[model samples]
Target: MSGTSAGAPEPEGALEPEGAPAPESAPGPRRRRVPRRERERQILDVAVQVFAKRGYHGASVDEIAESAGISKPMVYLYLDSKEGLFLACLRREADRLVGAFQGAATASGASPELRLHAGLLAFFAFVSEHRDSWVVLHRQASELSEAIAAAVAEARRAVMAEVADLVRAGIAEGGPATQLTDEDADFVTHALVGAADSLTDWMARHPDQSPEGVTLRLMNMVWVGMGRVLEGEAWKPVTG
Candidate 1:
């Protein structure tokens, strides 16, 4: 990662174009100059779509620039190259995901269970709405150069760290979760994140399941067991 991106490993990114300020464009003789930041955002927006649809190797600077209704030179100027553009996409989606979870989970006055529920809900909601971004984040990260792969891995680390913090907070709050130690929290973090990741496929199949609904079900499966087991209801082996 050190030598990537013209000597810089990676950079943080922009909104996912839901309500991003529209780029300035004109069909008239006089064209307004788009601000550099807005222009860069426009490029990245199109780039994410292209990379998701065409993948890392198949997508190209020419097509991305054209699709954004801009010139290739401007793309290079803003993002450096295709790899740079991909890295920005990866980082942006990662930020959007982590941001969603943190914002929901940290809402003032919310209990730990509610916070975790909100966080998990946000995650499923994100995957549902931003399928293309998820494609790039989930599927396309492994098929490129080493630097890009490392950056993708870092994105995963960021998500893992957020879940780890949530687990620690849940442990701090007195509850059935209180029976759990930091080590237990660590294990829970692994379980929760892994389950959520794998469940994206399950979610794809069952589109009828709302994010809130899915979150509630996961809570029942996990949090309920935490409570039940703390009440001396641990599972025991059957004697032969």
Candidate 2:
């Protein structure tokens, strides 16, 4: 919601009269002064929308400039280029989403089941609310150049680290997850990430489903899956 003046008002006098010397505007729309942090937010917000709609390759700095209602050079001044803008958007959303789940997990004070549910629910909620941002980060960022891929890897590493920490906690609590060794913990962490990523892609394709529905379904799946695994059940592993 916060960004460049939400597009300039109809050039003041342009709408008032075709010929008349239009009355001066009331010092113009309140220039919402975007400070450094807020300016970066605004840029990322615009970038998410543009990249989500057009994808990384299809999107242009010129289009992002137009969409953000800023000069092309200004977009460059803030984000450097298309790749920079896209990565900024990815980093911002990934950081927020990861932090949200981490906080939710620690603060829930519920059993591991409830904490896990709350964390996954929060994750889906973020993706639901910030669909554009989610898309840019989850989709476009993956296909970017090597430099951008490195940025994506860093963000992903942070998220995976949090997941691993939670997994360790779950194991310490002696739940079904407790059987996981360090290697198993890493595998489970990556599996959770892969599951969430797949769910995001699925929900994106099926916008008709409510966020609550998607969240609940994933919660049930994870809960049931972990419960089954804890019961000493195992599925066949793929062999090369």
Per-model RMSD to reference? 5.8, 8.5
Model 2 pairs whose backbones collide = none
Per-residue accuracy of model 1 over 1-240 as CA lDDT, tens digit each: 221232233334432224333333665575556655566667778988999898889999999988898777666666667788888788788789888988888883456677788889999999999999899988888777887788778877877887788667766654553566878778888898889988888888999988878889898887777656555577889999
Query: Which model scores highest in TM-score?
Result: 1
Give lDDT: candidate 1, residue 132.
Answer: 92
Which residue pairs clash in candidate 1? Answer: none
Backbone clash count for every predicted candidate, in the order shown = 0, 0
Taking all chains together, the TM-score of candidate 1 against the true structure is: 0.83
- lDDT tens string, model 2, 89-202? 766777788888888877888576667767777888899888887877777777778876886788889878877777666666665435657787687778887898898878
Q: Could you tell me the lDDT of residue 183 within candidate 1? A: 83
| Superposed Cα deviation of residue 8, candidate 2 (Å) | 28
Report the Cα lDDT for candidate 2.
0.70
* Candidate 1 residue spans exceeding 4 A from truth: 1-28, 174-179
